[model samples]
Target: MKAMVTTGARQMVVREVECPRPASGQVQVKLEYCGICGSDVHYYKDGKVGDHVLDHDIVLGHEVAGMVSEVGEGVTDLKVGDRVALEPGIACGKCIFCKSGHYNLCREMKFFADPPTPGALQEYVVHPADLCFKLPENVSSMEGALVEPLSVGLHAAGTGDVKLGQNVLILGTGCIGLVTLLACKARGAAKIVVVDLYDKRLEFAKKLGATHVINAKKEDVKKRVDEIFNGEGADVVLETAGSVITIAQTPFLTKAGGTIVIVGQSAQSEVSYNFSEVIVKELTIKSIFRYRNSYPVAIAAISSGAIDVKQIVTHEFSFEDSKMGFDTVIEDAENVVKAVIKF
Candidate 1:
């Protein structure tokens, strides 16, 4: 088996590694596709994200889906031939957060491509059965690979409590932002506004049902959003850019008493936020980690064509050209919205 290994900063290569076998309550998946995530390129280029640094030569990919080649004992619902999406977070089921059904917030979680955990860039990965979700017959393996990111979008909408006929503002046009657009539309948001610096991504967002697209680089995001909302503001604001400025602007851009959900992970530990603006506006600010228990719903949405994630996939590479895929994404950030590695 071959895997993409990042031995050092700006260093990556395809190396032969032993195939992984399933442990108890786990299954070995013969990977068909793994989406090259932003974090993967971060680890490959800078060797770290915030405080989480690459410890060992890690295989870097988390958005994974494939067919089950082997199933361990006690795995009854899934069989050897089932195609499934692999949720990359392995949480300690007994933790307080896990016990409270917020498994994504579990303190003791081993997330793929985060640091030490070897991710799904390999030919075969042994994952816990509980996290392996079976794909519907109508869903393709490439679509399965997108469920991981789409789950984030669903969770963001759920956290913000978006509802029918609400005006929503998304402060980024990345994969998560676009998926959040789909989720909001599905939840009956009458007006969805997407903001980003990239014209291509904004155009893509408009085609995907966004009522308005704002180029933050050219137009005033807050003013434009105010105009869209008739001089008030959006009912719910989703910040997915992971920048300090965007995170700071969320409270002010949101309507009074509206909810602001932070979906993107910021690079800085202590972001200087405007607490006075939040207090004055009486806003509810919430943050999302990764997703929990959202994969199944995302799969159903993608299968039903409610979410067209396939269009977000702009580039695809074979497992052999994994390094090139990473490089291409890092170099062509604007042109490549989503990149995948097929085995």
Candidate 2:
């Protein structure tokens, strides 16, 4: 098996490594596609995401899907030929959070590509069979890889409790932002407004079902949002841009008694926000770490034609050109919505 290792910032090399075999209750998957996430780009470009710095060589991929090549003992549900998406985070099932069905908050989670845990950027990765959700014949392997990020969107919309005929304001046009738009649209949001600096990404958002698109670079965000929402503000405001400015703009953009979901992780920890606006409006503020219990829902939504996850892909690269893929994502951030490595 071959693995793409990140030796340093913006440095990557292919190395022939030992193939991992599945242990008990696990399955060995022949990886087909691995999506490059924002965090992956952060690690590749700056060698860190907040405090989680890259101290050593690491494989940089977590959103992945593949076919099962071998099933270990006690793995009964998945067979050798089953196509599945591996949920990247493996939590310690005994924690209070895990027991309470909040496994994404489990303190002892060994998530793939999170520092010490090696990611699934190689040819073969052995994952727990229970974490591998089998994909239906109607869903492609590429869509399977997307389930991971789609889960975040599902979780965000579900947290905000976006209902039919409700209005939503997503503050970003990145991959996560577009997926959140799809989630809000699938949940029957009447009006979806997306905000971003790049016109290309905003155009992509419009194609993905955003009723209104606002380029913050060209026009004022608060003014456009007010006009679009009839001076009321959105029922649900989701911050997916991961920008400090956008994060601070959430309270002002949310409607009175509405919900504000913080979906993006900002590089800076502390943000100056208007808590007075939150209190005055009686708005609800919620945030998600990653996602929990959303893979099945995302897969079902994709299968039912409620969400077209495949439309998010703007670029694709072969496994051998993985470095080039990462470079393109960094250099052409505005044009590339999502890039996947095909093995």
Candidate 3:
């Protein structure tokens, strides 16, 4: 089997590696497609994201979908020839977080492409049978690969408690932001205002049902949101840009008693935030750490035609040109919303 390995910053190579066999309660999948996430881009360009630094060569991909080649001992429900989307994070079932169903916060989480754990960028990957969700007959492999990010969007909306007739503010137009918009619409948000510096992404967002698109470079985001909400601000604010500026602006952009969900993981650890306004307004601040128990819901939404997850894919690359896919994402930041590796 061939795997795309990142040796250092801005370095990647396709190298032959031994194919993995699934242990008990696991399954071996021949990967068909894998989406390159923003975290993957950060790890490729800087060799680190916050404290999770890439100390050694590792495969970089987590959004994955493929066909089951073989099922390990003790595995039931799923069998050979089943197409499935894999939930990347594996948690310690014995931990309190896992027992309580908040496994995304488990202390010992082995997430794909997160430095130590090898990802599905390779030709084949072995994952827990329980984590490999079967794809509906109507969903394609590429669409299946998108379920991971869609799950993140679902979790963000759920955390923010987005509801009907609420004004939703999204701070970015990237893949995650667009998916979050879809989730909000599915949840019956009346007005969705998406903010981004890129006009191309903003245009795409508009086509995908964004009620309004604001270019942060040309317009004042706070003023625009104020105008839309008649100075009351948005009911739900989701910060997906991971920018220090946008994260800090959440307090001002959110309405009194509104909820703000931080969906993006910032590269910087600390940001000077305005605590006085947050306290005075009585706003609720929440954050998402990957996602838990969201993959199934995302799949169901896509299957039911409630969400169009694949339209966010603006680029694709063959497994042999996987490095080029990463390069396209890095260099073409404005145009390439999402890039997928086709195996």
Which is the leading candidate under TM-score? 2
Candidate 3, which segments miss by more than 4 Å at Cα?
none
Q: What is the C-alpha lDDT of each candidate?
A: 0.89, 0.95, 0.94
Kindly list the per-residue Cα lDDT of model 1 for residues 1-343, writing each as its tens digit.
8888889887888788888788889999999999988888888999888788777788889999999999998899899999999999999999899999998888789999877777888889999998999998999999999998888889999999999999999998888888888899988999999999999999999988999999989999888887888877888999999888898889878889899999987777679899998898899999888888898889889888887778788899998888888889989989888899999
Ranked candidates, highest lDDT first: 2, 3, 1
RMSD to true structure for each model, in Å: 1.3, 0.7, 1.0
Question: For each candidate, what TM-score against the reference?
Answer: 0.96, 0.99, 0.98
Could you tell me the TM-score of candidate 3? 0.98
- Tens digit of per-residue lDDT, candidate 2, span 119-226: 999999999998999999999999999999999999999999999999999999888999999999999999999999988898899999999999898999899989
Off by over 4 Å in 2: none
Clashes of 2: 0
**Tens-digit per-residue lDDT, 242-278, candidate 3:** 9999999999999999999998867687998999999
RMSD of 3: 1.0
lDDT comparing candidate 2 with the true structure: 0.95
The local distance difference test score of model 1 is 0.89
The TM-score, computed over Cα atoms with residue i paired to residue i, of candidate 1 is 0.96
* Candidate 2 vs. true structure, TM-score: 0.99
Using lDDT as the measure, which candidate wins?
2
